[model samples]
Target: MVLGTSFHFDGQGTATAADAMKRYCGLLGEQEMEGKSSPQWLATKELVKDDGEMVFEEGISRFCPNCAKILKSAVEGTYPRLI
Candidate 1:
């Protein structure tokens, strides 16, 4: 499992967050496949206010072909997007 360093963001980090999560999912998915397991990934981000109180928390996961297609479609534009 890979642990990401803490990053602080406010109103202007949507792209940064998306990039980070994308990279994390890619790496984790590759690792899972390498280990002969069903490719999968789990990601969590904690959002807090300046006072450090938890404002929001989210967890995301992807498995196998779904994960593979999502990333691939972004780059290759081959797969139809899910609605």
Candidate 2:
């Protein structure tokens, strides 16, 4: 299990708070898999630089809608989500 920090978004736009949260989580997952750096990772890199230390959990476990194809090919298990 990939353990990582979870993010929260303020409900201020047309999208629901949950939607925003999922979007960001997906972005983070993509960055991790690609070995690419993201704003979130960059900001926290010094504080917590080890990628192995982060584990995807709960909402973070789901694949990004945009990157679903790649994830489907590589990852196991059915993607779980909150209704």
Candidate 3:
């Protein structure tokens, strides 16, 4: 399977899901939270429990820091024995 920084984006260098979220968040304005977790974290949890890889494939080939963090959590969560 493909690996590393190269898998981070498409030929046009766009991360559709993350980009869309950026725009969407911009329109929505800043959300002030003292300690609330990000929406991405919530979604990542669900994804890891479900079909996280497929979701990951559709977006950037590269894992953003958040994605990478959540993915590592998911992988470890899914396969404790391996860890």
Candidate 3, after superposition: displacement of residue 59 in Å?
Answer: 2.8
- Per-residue lDDT of 1-83 in model 2, one digit per residue for the tens? 32233323335443433454456555654544224344334233311323312322222344344443323433332333212
**Best first by lDDT, ranked:** 2, 3, 1
What clash count goes with each model?
0, 6, 4
Instruction: Give the TM-scores of the predictions, in the order they appear.
Output: 0.25, 0.26, 0.28
Candidate 2 lDDT score relative to the true structure? 0.37
- Stretches of candidate 2 off by over 4 Å are 1-13, 32-36, 39-83
Q: Model-by-model lDDT, in order? A: 0.33, 0.37, 0.36
52 Cα displacement, candidate 1 (Å): 13
Local lDDT at 22 for model 2: 59
Cα deviation in Å at residue 30, candidate 3?
13
lDDT of 3 by residue, 1-83 (tens): 22212322223453445553333233222232123233333244334433335544443234343344444444445422220
Kindly provide the TM-score of model 3 when superposed on the true structure, using C-alpha atoms. Answer: 0.28
Task: List per-candidate RMSD values in Å.
Answer: 13.4, 11.6, 10.5
TM-score of candidate 2 versus the correct structure, residues matched by position: 0.26
The most accurate candidate by lDDT is 2
